[model samples]
Target chain A: MEDFSIIKQQDEILREIEERQPMFTPVQDFSSLEVEYASNPPFQAKIPYLQSKYSGFRRTRGDGNCFYRSFIFSLFEQLIQNKSHLSNPDSPYSQIYSAIKQKVLDSGDILNAAGFLPICYEDFIDMISAKLEMIPTTEISQLEDDFKDKIIADTYVMYTRFIVSAFLRLHADEYSGFVEGYPDIVSFCNSEVDPMNRECEQLQIIAMTEAFQIKAEIEYMDRNDRTETTLMSFPFEYTGPDFKIHMLYRPGHYDILYPNRS
Target chain B: MATRTRLLRELKGKTEEFSLNNVGDDLMIWQAIIQGPSDSPYADGKFTIEFRVPENYPFAPPKARFITRIFHPNVHFDTGDICLDVLKSDWSPAWSLEALCRAIVALLSAPNADSPLNCDAGNMIRAGDMRAYNSMARMYTIEFAQERNLN
Candidate 1:
């Protein structure tokens, strides 16, 4: 296989995804996954176990961006669930939101340092700030409604995608060792990390979670993944606090998981 | 907010390449001008551009098009729709309108025919007919975008 380089330019990328994918598809409730998992055998062995653990999991469009999209919605869900705890300075949700806002602002600096097109990063920051400013009026239950508004959800997800891409490229030297056989860290990020529809790998995941510091846990649910150690924590250095999030990972995809002890 | 602040920054930092055409204080809908790059077909041309910002300003790229009609592989002849990546999906708020104007002027000198919004001009260049393309492009620039039209 040839080495990975930045694939199609922007116009081509937009056209490819335009025919089949919507910018943001509304996240339906979790009941739908229960139905699909019950019928599909490949996912059968894990259904009973998964159903016992998660109340519902929304499936992002399998456009190779399932990971980031799932992460945003899952974080949103957690934010709403813990909204009343806002006054607590240690609130995990509040911390993540503020961190996100800072990341949006800092993205400008990163883009400028790297000498990328200014308008591209500038416009994304604008969209990101608009959503961050809407927090006071955004109710917890209406979180799904916000997600339903394609514009609102797309804006937030685009913000996350942009930050993750910029973070990897800007700090290329620091994360270079993570991906082997790439031309260089900058090129690796341009092709792998920056572009939309590119799937997230271990290195990308680590950089993203660490940059934002939103502690995360992944419970693997694959055919070969049935051991007590299936679930794992990111950052590999977690003495500060346990993860506020619990996600179920199935090879290429990830979704939120809520344990149903009841 | 980002777009509004950015327009003000551009207004304050006006350069010789492009100047804001509107003084009405409507930041959302802006008019601007760019002098065609030297030694290019568009040289001596004064092109007007319309900058339209959506309510979602920086989130979505501000839509920009040439109000001046000219012949170029990267720019559409009739609508003056420019085929610039920064103006499209690659657009991020990191850019100010001033930067966009500079890039547009740069596009005047170097037209990438690989992906053409104006196939006629694009095909002429793609066929490796630089002599024909330059003359035709010059024709459009002189006829539609000239010094006489400058405000």
Candidate 2:
């Protein structure tokens, strides 16, 4: 009788393990994730190892709370599609990434995509909860969970918005003129002010403008008219109180747009 | 499907001169030419740029660089290192190649003297002396772009 019960218990445990194994399986090939990411350009270059790990997660498990694995896979795909355009060390993407990184002090979403956030968040929550022994308040416990959730939500939203805006802005000039019934490229240029955070407002404007440029580019490309190439040589320029941008574009194996005079 | 669709959109919307090239099964590269902004030192200049996107894009920022040498305080003289905030920690998934190109154009018009990748050039700009800055910039542009007839 005892032996039978032990066997039964073991079988139950095995079944449970089998059921949960898929969720725990690590992500393997991030290359498979290139599709969504390719749709939008990434904010930074990914490390290969990190990319592989993130891809593996997406392959095995669907979506974790952080969705970091999914994000990584998408970003990798975008990089692959745009690799030729990014060959130049001074390309616009590189410059913008450098510029944004320098300005933004904290970007949790980026950290998460790099595969550092999920585990960190878990550990952080664990540590804080452990401190409950000292203060032992139900309110505190509830507050901690709420705070963590808010942070996660904010991070995810901010990251997504930034990526979308950046993509649109980068291609605005190329696609703007071609978008039928779309707002004129010049009309899209407007100052945005944020009362909550002045710097955030500025960043948002920059992002919006960048998105506009990308939209314009995409619209132009869609026309498929040979005449579209005629506009290829037009330079994109930006004038802000703090900075002035003068960019040049050319055609070849890769799109070449560089700062200064290229 | 999403990636292909987006690429198609970008390609169709792009001016005919811009083309996307596949580097590997998982990498795609793009090439484009930009005209110099009017009234700037780079005016009438034709510049080329390259963008490299990895498979794990959007999460990781794409790598970009200038194919031709450029003269600017914010850009590295020898390495073409650019001082831009978005490429680093601030990178958001929303940024695209076109937006980046515009930013580069903007950077040329407004060189960031506050954060100088090229110390000498930055100093000249900060010193409030346009003479030295403009001269060196013009000389560098001529050497890299005009002499080579990149435009």
Candidate 3:
């Protein structure tokens, strides 16, 4: 009875928030964030440093799916914006896109090996592959519109979550040591990575980046009094190509960040 | 499109243990008939469950409740609502309608008395009265979960 009522309350609150906000808001300047934190001195102090590095950011709804949602949207936006290079077979962007697309398709084996039925995840794989195939020919606005469609956006996020869960489950020995409260990696993935609206933590982020073979940089922009926000790369010691996805992380939420051109 | 495909696939995978069907030709509403586990007191019974697929299918768990009443600790006696973690917080995109029905069948044999939706069933189990609990559960199984009742 207590559990039932608590879930009901959560649903009501989530519905109210959903009505007031879109899943993905258009990109906004750093100054807008400054205005939002005017009353908080620590956050205000950190804004100038953020503004110095990042030109702007797109705000994803603060729903627990923010991290994965931001990552997928930002990654697609990067591909869409550079579609000219992506379309040219000779370009490095085109090569990278080909490699990533193949890997995304190949991830189905991982999902299957982890004991998930094809019917359960094949549609998700199809959805992701179709979107990836559209990247070289589609416009950024089209991508934005797709993300605005809740069903489309959630399917992408859900697939991303499954890949991460699959990676962790298959490589349990490597991750079981890091699982804190849960008995093992499988249960940890079940509780944290598998559920919709469950917040993403550091372990899941590591698993997602590794599984997709995509480099990502997350800038920590919290309310703490830090002179500069910390830019942390997944695969912490990554010395490979530049990160393709950049996100601003503030406590429990994440938003896409666009770095200023040098 | 994905939901319909997945449900149609499930409809084709029906077995003697469980069978799935669209309620009134509506894909969003489904009904399943589960054969009781052999080792449990519900051995001779068959249970019917109603599943309401949410808009975000697979990502969100389908809403499931027993349409055939039974005596169980984790299932509400009056409302038939079940209180399983997988149906709530632990659901994954990897799980399908077939998987969920299998879990419900598993739950029938292993009832968690700690968080009971049916107080009578929970109290009987807590009091360590196996004779009383088994008979009551079997009696209800015979009364409401007969194969004819489901049909």
The full ranking of all candidates by DockQ, starting with the best, is 3, 1, 2
Full ranking by lDDT:
3, 1, 2
**Comparing 2 and 3 on DockQ, the stronger one:** 3
- After the best TM-score superposition of candidate 3, give how far the Cα of residue B79 lies from its true spot, in angstroms: 2.6
lDDT of 1 by residue, A1-262 (tens): 0101222354456556655664344444455655766765555566666655656555555566667766776666666566665556687656667766777677788766766655455556776577565665667557667665655665566666666766777777787777777878765765565555567888877876776677678877665544331677886775543335677787677766665536
**lDDT of candidate 3 vs native?**
0.85
TM-score of each: 0.69, 0.38, 0.94
Q: In DockQ, how does model 1 score against the reference complex? A: 0.13
- lDDT for B71 in candidate 1 is 87
Best model per DockQ: 3
TM-score of candidate 1 on Cα atoms, chains taken together = 0.69
**Candidate 1 CAPRI-style tier:** incorrect
Tell me the docking grade of candidate 3. medium
lDDT of 3 by residue, B1-151 (tens): 7667777766775555567888887989998888889989899899989999986686678999999999999999988999998998788777878888999999999988898999899999999998898999999999999877765
Model 3's DockQ score? 0.70
Tell how far residue B1 is off in model 3, in angstroms.
3.8
